[model samples]
Target: MTVRTRRLAALLAALSAFAAGCGGESDTDLVRDTVRSYGEASAKKDYQRICDDLVAKELLRSVEAVGLPCELAFKRGLQEVKNPRVEVGEVTVNKSKALVQVRSSAEGQPDSQDTLELTLEGGEWRISSLAKAQPQPPQPAAP
Candidate 1:
């Protein structure tokens, strides 16, 4: 592994350890909290928190795979976003995995629907992946 990868792994491990003893939150709430927190962090441009506390290690690894650290990569992707808003809808949990429905909107942009996959890690819910829903086909105009 590269030095940056090692450092990121160490950072994640440390953060995980810090959260190892936290408990009492239901799976649904935990999953939703993670999503809401990620939205807040993204709006505030707090990429480090989003990388370390909100997202799964695998997602961070994907950023590193492209030769950039998680924070830089995630920030780059959101640079064009403004005044973001996140609304959590449905949350379904099965053991350590969960799926959360979200509606996201930003200034001058159309709202987007997405589902985020989360996993329980070190007693905390962490987002593993996010998939934007495909746009619905428009109906034909009536005669």
Candidate 2:
């Protein structure tokens, strides 16, 4: 083979290796994705997925505070919210923790924003806490 052809083959191999390495999502991105999944599962009342996968085991206590199983509590929470659609926003990650901002809207209601706290547990990102975001003042009109 000509020298040019050999060089091209080497470049192609390198590019393939780089693409393979990029297949895994970063920790921040994983947290954002997990939050999205949690929202979808909650809206669908798929409590099993929420309790077993999306939420950290430590959060089970809060879910069971009402004397119900975690899955049952999740179901009740979803019913109260009603058809929630979550939009994930900026995400920040620390060593084993991540925070994701999300806006959720239910039918006939204004959007509610929350900050989700996630922890890297058992090789996966799982939500540990959720808190309402502080409302910001309206911005002035642009000149």
Task: Write down the lDDT that model 1 would get.
Answer: 0.87
Reference-based lDDT, each prediction = 0.87, 0.86
Clash totals, every prediction: 0, 0
Backbone clash pairs for candidate 2 read none
lDDT of 1 at 11: 99
lDDT, candidate 1, residue 118?
94
Tens-digit per-residue lDDT, 92-127, candidate 2: 999999988888777766677788899889999999
